[model samples]
Target: MPYQIQSYFLEIKKANLQKLRKDIWSDTPVPAILQVGDTRNNIAICYRGSYTREFRKRSYMVKFMEPNTFSDAHVIHLNAEYRDPSLFRNKLSLDFFQDLGVLSPESHHVNLIRNGSLKGVYLQLESVDEIFLKKRGLPLGPIFYAVGNGANFSLYKKGKRKKSLTSGYTKAFGNESDDKYLIELVKQVNNTPLTDFPRIIFKLIDIEKYARWLAGAVCTMNNDGFTHNYALYRNSKTGLFELIPWDYDATWGRKVSGGIMEVDYVPIGGKKTNHLSFLLLQVPEFRTLYRNILEEILETKFTVPYLTNKITSLHQTLRPHILRDPYKKKEIELFDGETEVIFQFIHDRSAYLKKRLKYLKS
Candidate 1:
């Protein structure tokens, strides 16, 4: 139902496209216009992501501007979802997170046309900014994006110092002049001993809510969310930090970045270094809580029946457009086959986790 609603148009100058590709990594935005549902507004467009931007079909970050904008949103993201052969990875993951009560960006599939040529299907994600907080009735506190591959929340390696930890995040909203709270939190997380980790985590983060978010990520097998491809926000109301997941095209059994992730793969950073989980798992109570949450998710949201139905419905909705997409890389059969893979993953992953957990408690 999401992809069926409307077709969005992005019109930009031909020269700007060349410039955007030339300096793909730059934060500089090229001026453009975005039209959605009979409403048009001025938008600044920029190529987004580190690895995905280098791909032929690029993702984008769009900032809505001008006095007569269509909506109150200051920014939005267009994910090319190039790595996802299924193309429904982001949509399904975000939807699951929201269903579990995580405050995340709302995603809708869009038929994107650039300069009158069909670009293909894109996922339009609601930006995680002040507007997003207001819409969800969440406190607009400091929001920082865990950008780059180096965005690991570790006490070792890149997170050896406070400056190193904060450097990995790009602060999008709230006070830019001071990052004392963020620095202090990082220091506490890294320097605090394992013995005191569980008690202290309650002060800095909402452990129960965060556990649900973590469960969703682990069940989906999103290797990117823990240390990178996430937005960390400090809630002004609760005064605790929370994580929002991003870039999930690599999930659901297939590695988008050219590696095969097994059903038994550890979700906390996968093969990467993750100090946060390393410390948390050291705490017995936290480990128990996480295991419980994972079990609950497997019985409910991550079940084969639930996910298979969801994937089947989405595949039906998207199949027609995908067949006609000019920028599509794979064949129609591959697109259709991906839904089966998703269904298989749900069953296989749930069974694998159940067996793993039997030994985990001992």
Candidate 2:
């Protein structure tokens, strides 16, 4: 069966479009009309992402006005994915995380049309917010995004004490009072004595859930996911924090700039920058659990044969659209060969992890 790419039409005033382009760094959204099929709604559009803002084909964040939503999402991210030639890494990583029983945003490929002009293929990602939790039958809670390196679960940055404990995070959901929860979590993670760390941390976080998330990041080799490119939600019922993966275009053996990254680039536990993971691994029980999770994932999900089939299927589905895409037509050859690159990455990454399982044991 041929893959169907949903088409989104954006109607924006020429003045607003120029204003948005003039200040690529601004988060302010310009009023626009969006149409999908026969459905139409008012939306606020703005440029999103840090480095990708400079790209000719930039990404966008669309906010649907009240009483008007697209696919039950009040907000959605349209990623140009100009950096990743395959344009499959982010969705692939999110799906893999879901398979491991972790909460992750849903995404699919869609064609975006701006002012009747084809802007090429984009990955439409469901926003992780109150609606996301309600859709999954989960309770709403305080949600914070790790916006920068200061969200390393530490009170310091670059060997100096941080001026604010909440420097790297932006509260996405909840009131001003909810900020204390994240602040307290960071304090406990950094100041808890080694002998009493496990007892204290088990109350703050779900170790198994964190292990699964860590394992997913390790398998995908997402260098930036540990300290950033993720979200934390404190479950109101359980009062424990859980992780939600995000912004993973730089995974699956590729760097953010679309360059080749070695299979063993990131350590099994994760980057040392994250103090939470560091403290968790210090407890033997947590280390064992994390290692076991990685082993199970490697044996089942991360194998080359398993992923090759997935990569091949996605490659076939995207080929026709990719060839016709004006921005991507020049790199048709590179796009066609990306499946093999991803397969080789799976093979080498799995082998490296299998051999390094001993490190986790020690």
Candidate 3:
């Protein structure tokens, strides 16, 4: 008989979190070197998750890291044994998004096995965008901002230790009073540093554009989107914070939902009450920038049917991966109901925004 792996695997939560990392991986291993952030998994790191490394090969460097607090390399709430035909999904997401002209990283699939069977799966991604940034005249992160937008870069220090490394938004705009003793949070603004691209807020129109892109995308293929998950970073010289998306968990499939899951309420713009309008009001130069984004997105709007068709094609391709687990087999069925609700949601949202736009114009 094939070596039967238990449903529960080397999982981690609470105190054993570090131990779980030690269980399957080691700190000394060349791949686990973390570069930034205090939280474990969310921190950017070099991960070697693909085929074993050899000197002759292109080298073992995959950017599998995400900015999550949970530190889970693999997630399972659907009671699934492992992520479904996982390798192919990454490729599907990359190709589809890139083809759609959204900035995305290139990904490769690598078959993974544990205890002599395929128990765990992951993707090997090389951020060609990062490489492109280097090859092009622009520097990776800091220097690009410093030179292009006059933004400042700071090594966030805690006492003697440099705790975090972050770049973007201006330094001169903040004060010590912004740091609160109760919440312990110094209000954060995600943008290019030094340069005031309040206009970056205008890129919110892309949400609708992306919504339209996804309206069909969600219907044809079960998809999920969360706020702040869609990132916009403007190259100061370009005067554009290109709407780049990341963390495509519920993607490239036709998921069936009996009812709206918690993931359905996924809000954009973080815990804000009213997302787009609130953001426009908070940012200083929103009206002028939004006018520009609205014109562009509407001009090149990807229709519902077109998006649905593309996503449906993608879902068909990802069938093997989507059905790898028994639970995932049922999960795809759940998506059918979910998509109808999500579709109507965006429709209402678009009309509401249209009303808002009219009010603003008046």
Candidate 4:
């Protein structure tokens, strides 16, 4: 069965397009007109991603002009997903997080057309911001994107004291006041004594949500998720921080460059660089909760049979469009065989985690 995907057309002035191409590192957006099924709106678009900007098929960040939005989303990410041959890892990881009751971005595959030419299959992701909160009926709060390795919830980076506590985060939605909150949280995470860590940390962040988010990241084995590639949102009702995952293309047994990775590469506790996760797991209660979350997900959503069906469905839905996509023509074989790779990873990862669940008890 063929999956129907919405197509978006973008028209940019030749001069603006040239400028955008010339300055691939620029954060500034270029003016463009976007049309989808008779609705046209002025938008600003810019290249998105770090190393991915150098790829032949680049991703884009599209911001809708004020008072206009696409499906209630003021901004959207059109990811080339050039690194993932399967082109399903990011969507899979996000859906997995959602299934685990974690607040995650919603995504779907879409065909992007620029200057009357097909830019190929792109995963359209809902941006995490104030609008995301409103749509989900959640109270408005500060949202920050962990943009670099320094976002490891530590007071120091590379053995040096960070000049600013919030060095690695970009405030996606928040005021100057929010920075103090994040700074305080990081200070508590790193400065609080081990004996007093649990109580203080618990009050600063939602431990249960953090555990689940940690388990989700561990399960997907996202190499960069713990340190960065995540969003922190302060829950207005609870006044505690919660996590939202992002940039998960380098997951599911694949490295950022699409190379195969050992299933057990990421430890059950997650990367050691993330001080928050490391500190939380030190408490027996948090460890047990995280283990339980992983166990439940493994028995249910992360199982071979369950995920095989998912991978198969996604592969089938994407196969037709992917084969027709000019950008991915050279890697059709890898795309075709990606399901098996993912299935193998699931089997190995589940067994590895089940065996290691004992470590959490101590």
Per-residue lDDT of candidate 1, residues 89-173 (tens digit): 8889988998887777888788888888888988888888888898888877999888854556654555344446576788878
What alpha-carbon RMSD in Å does predicted model 4 have with respect to the real structure?
A: 1.1
- What order do candidates take by lDDT, descending? 4, 2, 1, 3
Global lDDT of each candidate: 0.78, 0.91, 0.33, 0.91
Put down candidate 3 lDDT per residue, 28-58, tens digits, no spaces. 3222322223433322222232122211111
Error of 4 at 38 (Å): 1.3
Ranking by TM-score: 2, 4, 1, 3
Question: Total backbone clashes of model 1?
Answer: 0
Pick the winner on TM-score between candidates 1 and 2: 2
| lDDT (Cα, tens digit) per residue for candidate 2, span 138-189 | 8889999999998899999989999989889999898999999998998999
State which candidate has the highest lDDT.
4
State in Å the error of residue 315, model 3.
1.1
Every model's Cα RMSD, please?
Answer: 2.2, 1.0, 13.1, 1.1
Error of 2 at 62 (Å): 0.3
Q: Any runs in candidate 3 off by more than 4 Å, and if so which? A: 1-102, 107-111, 120-129, 135-139, 143-243, 248-285, 295-302, 330-332, 335-349, 359-362
